[model samples]
Target chain A: MLRSQFHIELNNMHVELDKMCHLVIEAIDRCVEAFQNHDLELAQEIIRNDKAINDVERSVESKCLSLILKQQPVASDLRDVSTALKVVTDLERIGDQSADIAELILEMDEKDSYLMIEHIPSMARVAIEMVTSALSAFHEHDIQKANEVKKHDREMDQLFEEVKLELVQIVKENKDHVDLAIQFLMIAKYFERIGDHVVNICEWVEFNQTGKVNDTRLI
Target chain B: MENKIVAKNVNLHYGSKHALKNVSLDIKENAITAFIGPSGCGKSTFLKTLNRMNDYVENCKIEGTILLDGEDVYDEKVDTTVLRKKVGMVFQQPNPFPMSIYDNIAYGPRIHGIKNKRELDRIVEESLKAAALYDEVSDRLHTSALGLSGGQQQRLCIARALAVQPDVILLDEPTSALDPISTLKIEELLLDLKDKYTIAIVTHNMQQASRIADYTAFFLVGEMIEYGQTKDIFSIPKDKRTEDYITGRFG
Candidate 1:
């Protein structure tokens, strides 16, 4: 079981993956916080940190390539390395969507208070939890927990549809607040996409655990 | 594709050492099939069984059926010389006979009863051309085959096989002894040759098999572990042992 240098290198790669997860998690949290408070400075900060996530993504990729070439990993070990390659892309996309949500927040002119903004926070919370749980499932090699993360994405999707219906109601109820409702819908759409990325991460978790990228589990 | 040869439940033992275990496979016509595995895993032993090359070994006993064109090759009435002519083998080393280049290519034809000089010259030219060595060695037909480089000698060996007009060519690690450029040229030549003749190659190199073979059989510990399309074997092997071996995890 102790494969000397290869074992050590794979463990190190796992630690690097945790760091990538941390960066993505932070981006999601910051984007949600800035959107909730309508804080322009914090939104700009979320935009800036996407660069850090991109850097980690590239590093993880090259490290994976090195491990494959040097260690020639196979079977479960190969699946681990290959899934790491795939997971980083989904994680990187999560960071970009968070930044895009932040950018949209910057456009939604000052709304001191909004009626339909209630669901946005829960959608953000669900998206972040799905990502966190999916990463934990990957780290633990838990197929059941990964499947649970996929199930949580459906909740996020339902919340997305609910927000869309509410926005429609608001557009019909008051023409004055139509612009604000549309922005909320865009933010909800971004969160739903981020949740889909989380589902993709869970599917890749299945790939790492079983060496099968289950297409049926795909968003 | 039609099968050029079929091996059914073949087993071999060398003085109580079981070298092959129930090995059966169909070699498709005009396509290259590669046998890949670790050393002493019986890939070479099975390749020999195809042509009865194991008959000379002391204490070697074989149990199996090998059919070439639906004719039982192991039957007492079958002639090994005729079988070998149909199944020409190239070894791990560049083994050109100690003779002129023309003579080396002409050796098989002469053995098959071609005595005319003009006829021999034409076979020599055409065989060398078919082996992709004609341009380099055409002018040196009378020169010593031993005088050529290692790569040239191997190609001459191939040209020698081609002269026999064999239906199936067996290559045993043919490029293991050559340089990279020579290896690539031989690979290219084999690709061209497959359009006319069925070829079975035994190589330790997985990439070489993946690069050239249409079907690959993975052997291990004297057993045929997995056999399938080349892409499937390399990408998603059904057997754990095959996956482990191809991924360089198994010793």
Candidate 2:
């Protein structure tokens, strides 16, 4: 290798990004579990762990800046570093949105049966799968897999619409359930946003692979 | 943009050793084209061929067609002196003729028989201004060219090249010997000069190539590996060797 130190530093950055992906994925998974079971303790734990994801983002950002300053990477190396810089922002947002869902879970009334709506949990499951698949596409450098993740977002959006309609029906039947329905709506919206973040991550993956986003060349 | 120089199937040999193998490309008019590769990759040899700088080498054999403004550069009827006047060159180091700065810029015009003091003075000032060095050295025109900083010397050399009114300027690693600020000044000067003169540079600095070059060609082991727009060449190179070379994975 011509630039062994640069390759090592780039590899370390990739490992850190992989770590961040897992951290965000775990936060989303646990937040959904906490929401499904109304586990306040787990929800609070997820919120606290969000700091770790943010710290990883900071580490990746610093490493990227160092690579750019020290290595002056070009071609695919430039794309890789720039994509990592962009991917971390989306990953950090995914972490924050997961924490937001955990906070919403904490605000849910104990007597409410919003979990019975069913589609919200399904949305959470699809969101987690989308995030996992998207990061896998990133780590694998698979554009086809990234495209698959994008296709999965459509399923997430569909589930979100179903949840929105179900919540509206519940609120229409009984005005007393309006407060809990709003909470459920917020939770579904968070998952939908997570799906969007996963899609963004996939787009970065495509850029890392092809140097284009949505058919537009960025590099 | 029209092509200022077109080279087709150019091959060169220094005795028995092949230096450049069938290299071909177009140097666009009023644009910067950068040739880049590792040392011994024939990038410099190829650049030298554009101006026939290799004609002095012993046992050197060249075969190819090189056109400057649609005229064959190798035609026996062509005057090399006039060819060189139209195709000026600057070297890697700032080889300012150990004379005063004013004389340095005026040397080319003087050699071409422009002896009128007023005309030489006008050419000196205009070339220095065109090179972005007039403000720094206008008061010190009589100072020794060697006394200037490395970057200033390089710009002075460029000014000397420009004093002759060349249609094309060829720079061989123009900023390799300078500091960052000087290098940036040279880069900015080249960017500005591209509006009037065609520029072909052979650079070891890939960032400099990506920064100022509108078109880039990557050479490897005497072969032209890839050629394209600077943005695509630096972002998503088509050839894997070009990618590996640019990304510093291997060269």
Q: Alpha carbon lDDT of residue B150, candidate 2? A: 98
**Model 1 docking grade:** acceptable
TM match of model 1 to true structure = 0.87
Clashing pairs in 1: none
lDDT of 2 by residue, B63-159 (tens): 9999999999988898889999999999999999999999999999999999999999999999999999999999999999999999999999999
The residue-level lDDT of candidate 1 at B197 comes to 96
* Residue pairs with backbone atoms closer than 3 Å in model 2 (clashes): none
Q: Report every candidate's CA lDDT.
A: 0.88, 0.92
Per-residue lDDT tens digits for candidate 1, residues A1-219, read 335677778878888888999999899988878877888999999899999989989988988999988866655667778889999999999999999988988887765343346676789889878888888898888989999999998899999988888788877888997777777888889899998888888888877655567744221
lDDT of candidate 2 over A1-219, digit per residue (tens): 788899999999998988998899899889878877788999999999999999999999999999999998888899999999999999999999999988987888656554678798789889889988888898999999999889998999999999989988988999988888888888888889999998998999889978999889988
Instruction: Score every model by TM-score.
Output: 0.87, 0.96
For model 1, what is the C-alpha lDDT against the true structure? 0.88
Worst 10 residues of 2 chain B by lDDT: B242-251
- Which sections of candidate 2 miss by over 4 Å? A109-111
Q: How many clashing residue pairs, candidate 1?
A: 0
- As a whole number from 0 to 100, the lDDT of residue B239 in candidate 1 is 89
